[model samples]
Target: MDLAAEVAALTDEFSGVVRVDRAGSTVLDAAFGLADRRHGVPMTVGSQVAMASGNKGMTALAAMSLVEDGTLSLGTTARSLLGDDLPLVADDVTVEHLLAHRSGIGDYLDEDVESDIDDYALRVPMQELATTEQFVTVLDGFPTKFPAGERFSYCNSGFMVLALLAERASGTGFHDLVDERVLRPAGMLDSGFLRSDDLPGTAAVGYVRMDGHWRTNVFHLPVRGNGDGGLYTTTADMHRFWVALFAGAIVSPETVALMTTPRSDVPAEGQRYGLGFWVHASRDVLGLSGYDAGVSFRSFHDPVERLTATVAGTTSAGAWPIARLLEERLVTTSPAA
Candidate 1:
């Protein structure tokens, strides 16, 4: 299959960037559609776009770095760290459970099995969620779904607790901890948790299509990112992240192995859950994905082939089709796939 042709055909329907790297070399890099439709800004290769839940990968990395430094352990429990702050969360819900999405804790912004992504309501006002601590108030009301380590269920609130744990352990803010432990060490200088309302010109504005008209996603998400999501990065910075992560620059090799190791199966998606990534065991692929109102992102790295592919879109559903096509092409043609 001609990868370029496949992506070219998607240009009309998708509005974002597609990038692929092989053996630490750039193999493909292309941009499509508008970054800021109102301002007539075209999406560029250098534009930084939001990665909603994709930020979970960095949260996991930050938490694991503390584990590497003997500051925390996978076995550390939320009850032990939080100590009655979140009274309903079970005592057995550990850091490992949260990292692997096995924490049966109730989610504040629960993505119900049948709900539309765009219509999923935020429990709190979007403008109020500025920090991880603020998220704790939102997370407080939901009852625990099941026993800790019972099964795999994606829970955003669990990660918020993990971020709190990291902060307590490191004596640093969650954002600063991630920057110091994950981004800077990975050489991702351009990536950080910037506020949605205050993004600079280099960052793409998120969009959503409503009532046959394009609309900004400014009102659909938190004002600023927390541990669960809302991170912005460039394709080039993500490429550098993959390189540094695999090279054991951010965390130790043993920690990486633990993170990428598949601990549970996600039968619905036909994938497996690792510490913070999705693992395709058959293809030796590791990925981190995110989707929210006016935000879509998928990034993958194949360890054996040293290949990386990323699709980041500024619209809610724009990145999926392109990402799926790329996955099909790579799986059928790439030697590692």
Candidate 2:
């Protein structure tokens, strides 16, 4: 698909990183724009960028690890562990329902309802939302959208509740559990939930375009990532993640099969969904995507081919267009397709 040629036209404005790895080797690695415009720090392939909702895949893995070790189970109801924190979630909502996005629970950040992307969308200051427990206040008040297991309506709060469930069941923090069960075993040394306010030099600054000016996403998103989103990783680490996940490093081979097994047909997304990853509607490609006020990311992996293509950037919209191009190319050329 002439990867370089496709990415060239947008080089002037694309702010982030893009890379492709095939069969244990790098096929493409390119960095564009800046990590921090204020400091004039150019983005590098090593620069860490937020994955937004893309982190859900990791959250799912963390929950599955608990299941694998008998600390939790798919049949475990949210009410059993969460108690009275989120009273809106029905007692029938289970861990499996949450993983498959069929929980039908009230979503804190409900996408079905129309709301602009801003800090005000959260009921409290974004900075206060640094941990999974801190999210209950903001997650409060939204009513259940449907009956449990009624349908596949994507719910961000479902993952948050899963994190809470895992924590209660495993006696571990959500972020720490993910690190131990997902990132650590996946060989993803560079990925973790980094606080947006105190980012390290290796991480990119999330920037939202506001009124013809560029601004940091510090105020528009949570201070530290929670269940639904907010984790940082380099393109290199992301590639490692895909490889390890399929190699049965993060979860069992049987569990991997379960996770990648398509559960619902999402026509709106033009794809099907497994546990936490997005499944290709017609092919063997698995994808992860994220978007927010100052973050955009998408990663596609062909398990059999051991090929990965990822587009991650600091702006809310930069990576998707390029990701669409990559997906089209992959869908056509994937061996399993």
Candidate 3:
């Protein structure tokens, strides 16, 4: 890929970081536009940007790690940990089904139903969503969509339930456990869930275009990310994560294989999906994609070639144009419409 040229072509639409790593060395590191528009702080390669649902892969890794250690099993039911919390989840919904998106559980953020990126989707205030335990209130009222193990249905609630299960199974906070097992071992020191209200100097502020003006997305998203999304990471850290995952540092190679094995074919998306990661239809690339009210992000890695490419943008639609450039060059010849 003409990484520089492709990124430059989307200068007007893309406003974030793009990084590519090859053979364990940085091949491309570029940043554009503003990280904080009000203060005029430019986005940089080091700026930590939110990954939205892209971090679902990390959540999957944590769950798989628990399974490897016998703390949980693929057959373990969400009800085992949930007790009477979400009364709508089927008793037969297993961890594996959840991981593979076949749990048939109703999603709180149903992507199939919700089309507006700028809409106020949350029922409660954003501050009330700081902890996994607090999310149960919002997850309520949704009915089960299908029988457990019925079919592949991308679910945000499935991952949230996994986060809740992870907390109960390990007796550790979801953030701490992910850091301990997924980030720390992978050497991703630049990544973590940060409070949207009190962002650090190194973090990027997500922006939404409102009535011809730009505003921060502090109200549209949760204060702190949960199982499904809302984690901030840099391009470099993402490359490290991919390398570490493939090198058997974060989890066993066998476990990694299981997670990346294609479980369903999502033709609407023109790709396949594994347990927690988006699978390439005709290539060896495993992908991560996230799109929220103010954040857009995607990462694709080829284990055989040791290539990792990631793009993150502040506006929800900015990253995709650049992502298509990368996808066309590295992922597949027939891109999804």
Using Cα atoms with residue i matched to residue i, what is each candidate's TM-score against the true structure? 0.97, 0.97, 0.97
Which of the two, 2 or 3, has more lDDT? 3
How far off is residue 126 in model 3, in Å? 0.2
* Order of the predicted models by lDDT, top scorer first: 3, 2, 1
170-197, model 2: which lDDT tens digit per residue?
9899889999999999888999999998
| Number of backbone collisions per candidate | 0, 0, 0
Candidate 1: pairs in clash: none
Best model per lDDT: 3
Error of 3 at 18 (Å): 0.2
- lDDT per prediction? 0.88, 0.89, 0.91
lDDT per residue for candidate 1 within 1-337, as digits (tens), equals 5777888788796778899988867878999988889989888999999999998999999999999889999899888889879899998888999999999999887765567777736767888888778877888978888899989998888889999999988899999999999999999988999988899998999888889988888888889887889999989989999889989999998889889989898877878989988988465688989999999999998878888899999888899998898777775477744
Error of 2 at 111 (Å): 1.2
Error of 3 at 199 (Å): 0.4
Candidate 2 lDDT (Cα, whole model)? 0.89
Candidate 3 lDDT tens digits, 16-92: 99988777788679999999999999898899999999999999999999999999999999999999999999999
Q: Compute the lDDT of residue 283 as modeled in candidate 3.
A: 76
Look at candidate 2 and tell me the lDDT of residue 42: 94
Query: Which runs in model 3 stand beyond 4 Å of their true positions?
Result: 333-337
